[model samples]
Target: MNFWYVPWFILPYLLLAFILVKQHKKSNRSNLFFKFIYWSFFYLFIYLGITEIQDKSYFFTIPVLFFVLFSWMYHREKARVLNGFLLNLFIASFGIYLLYNFLITQDVLVFALIFLVGVFVVLVGLFGFVGLMILFYWNALVVIKRESHSLANLLTLILAVVMTIWLIYDSFIAKMLPDWASILLSILPMMFFYFVFAFLNFLSASLLYQFNQPSYDQDFIIVLGAGLVQGTKVSPLLANRIHKAIDFYYQQRKYTRHWVKFIMSGGQGPDEKTAEAIAMKDYALQQGIPEDDILIETNSTTTLENMQYSKEIIDRADIKAPKVIFSSNNYHIFRAGIFARMAQLKAEGIGAKTAFYYLPNAFLREFIAIIAMKRKLHFTIISLLASVLLLLSIIAHFVS
Candidate 1:
């Protein structure tokens, strides 16, 4: 037998192990997509390496590796428990198939294994589609629930729930039928779901455009800062934010929400001459925001700190509970909420319009932020669960 396959199995794992060790020691972890890709490659290499070393069959190792990974995921404390469960199902189902093929004389076991695998695959697909729907609709519900009065809220919530249930029912029924029919039915629904989700984001932004400007009772409107170009001139990204703030200021004046103080929150970059807050103030005045109502908060750099520090300035004049709005790009609304909640501020997160090309990039950044904040509990649970499941499967393999 050619031994050339040995190094091929060993090299990727060696690199993967290196990266994993490096990442574990770092204060910040890498993106989930990268982590998954690296780990997948690592696991694949390990399975192949083990097969080569033990002179065992590839089929057994492949299924066994999947079982271990899935079991680890299942028992682990990650939010992806459903994923782990499905993977475990695949491994367990595959294991049973192998066992029946080797130990039983009947073809019925093979048929049963096939049936199990089919069901498992269908369920996994359903879970993925539904999970996406849940995430999207939940975000949509949050917007609707917040903006809508009680009557509207009730109707919207019911509609959302009904739509979700309908999707699940439709998927289950279609999958229960013949294979070709199932595939055909699944395609349109899944595409429609994604289409709706994509358009809902736009709809959400449109709703944001209707934010009432400050009239007579308005006190202050705050514009959150994005990173500047070279820490000096406002990046086009940040310009969008400033532009919205200017619009809000003018709109409020138009609607009789007059003399709203504009507070810009951001610290100066090391390379920039002035703080972001100061720069924003200058930019707004350049665009005709009166210098008197414009206050600059230049001390803090973070979103939370931006809010906190700005509130200090706002409170100096005995205006603590101002009907404040913090503006950021649309993708950042949820995270800005988290920071606002943390700072104990009474503020509504208003999203400014962002460029379409920039949104995908912005969303990726937000997703990474969410993962980093809750990684330990997530990773630890996932690892432990996967390990336990793998152990149980191993014991079961030996005993059976």
Candidate 2:
């Protein structure tokens, strides 16, 4: 057994220990990303060591170690969606590694059996596209029946149909196209998968944050407003947010000696009879909250404006070192938190429950919004990946 691979395994541990110490000293999202990267490298090194030593039995420990670390990180910060996503990716990579190892080491009979199973899985996946189209159409029709026929409401259904079509074309029709056209078509699926990965990350993070209980030490509770019904009354979505903020206020009062101020943030829209802030305030007062305890921010329409204007109100109140909590519907909390961060407000979020039927469309909209928020970065990554794929295709064409 060559001991040279031992140091390769040990190096990642040392690096991770340093990162862990840094994270403990000053925790932030970037630190979490670094920790994930380091942990992945740690596992990769372990796999390398196992392969070098020819100890196939040790392969089983990789996944066990992955689960242990994933659970520990998830327990530490349940609200971090990116962390969950990284852990999921790690497990997937490990599974692939195991499959590769099995193919290399197993007997011919076992290989043939595995190959047959693999082919079966592929065939099922191909046929599964039809099932996916059915599901998508059903969801689309249900959404159209229950909601308005607006493009926003139909986004998920539209995307599902488009993806299904693209997959079919890429699988069967791309090979018949010109080389450049085929390369471009092939790149679409990769980009789609990347988008799907990102969407899942944001959705998981949002859902995790929604389910976790808010801490009771907040100094302020901000309720973000949605559009009103008929431009006057509070919509069900907006009402849920106010109720969530009130619940948090009462929960905090049980533990804290200070009063938690409620900031109702929303401006009047062109279609509204009154400012969203005014409507939310009136609703909160009717719900039995004192007028003195509620502060109205009546000049903001968007979530970012909600954060910015609300922060001004918090500042005007002369509250020092305010720990704030914002409330929105569950699907909206992740993006709301991002907005709060953009406004330089140190705030956590609590999500009220949303209707189950509405969640998929809502989540899809939020995912698109998040992508738009970092459009430059996303464009750069997709362009680079596509370019590489195109280059590889061109090289293969020339070689052949």
lDDT of 2 by residue, 1-400 (tens): 2345446655877787776777555333434554566576566545554563474445545655775676677656554556558667665755565576555544343244457767987888987867766776778888988899998899868988887888779778987887766775678889988998888787766765665555567778999988999999999889999998998787667656557889999999999999998999999999999999998989997999999999998888787798888999988888888788789877878888988878888889988998898899999999999999989888767865
- Give the alpha carbon lDDT tens digit for every residue of 1-400 in model 1: 2346546645877786777767655221223334554477457545434544454444545555665565465334222324424544564656564454434322343345567777887887887855755655665456454443444234334545666876776857755765444443444445444434433443333332223222234576778886677767887778888887677666666656456787889887777877888778878878876788888888887888987887787778686567777777767765675576567666665567775534543554554565466678656755665555556555655655
Q: Candidate 1, residue 171: CA error in Å?
A: 23
Tell me how far the alpha carbon of residue 270 in candidate 1 is from the true structure, in angstroms, after superposition: 1.8
lDDT, residue 29, model 2: 40
For all candidates in order, the CA lDDT equals: 0.60, 0.77
Name the 10 consecutive residues with the lowest summed lDDT in model 1: 206-215
Give per-model TM-scores: 0.47, 0.72
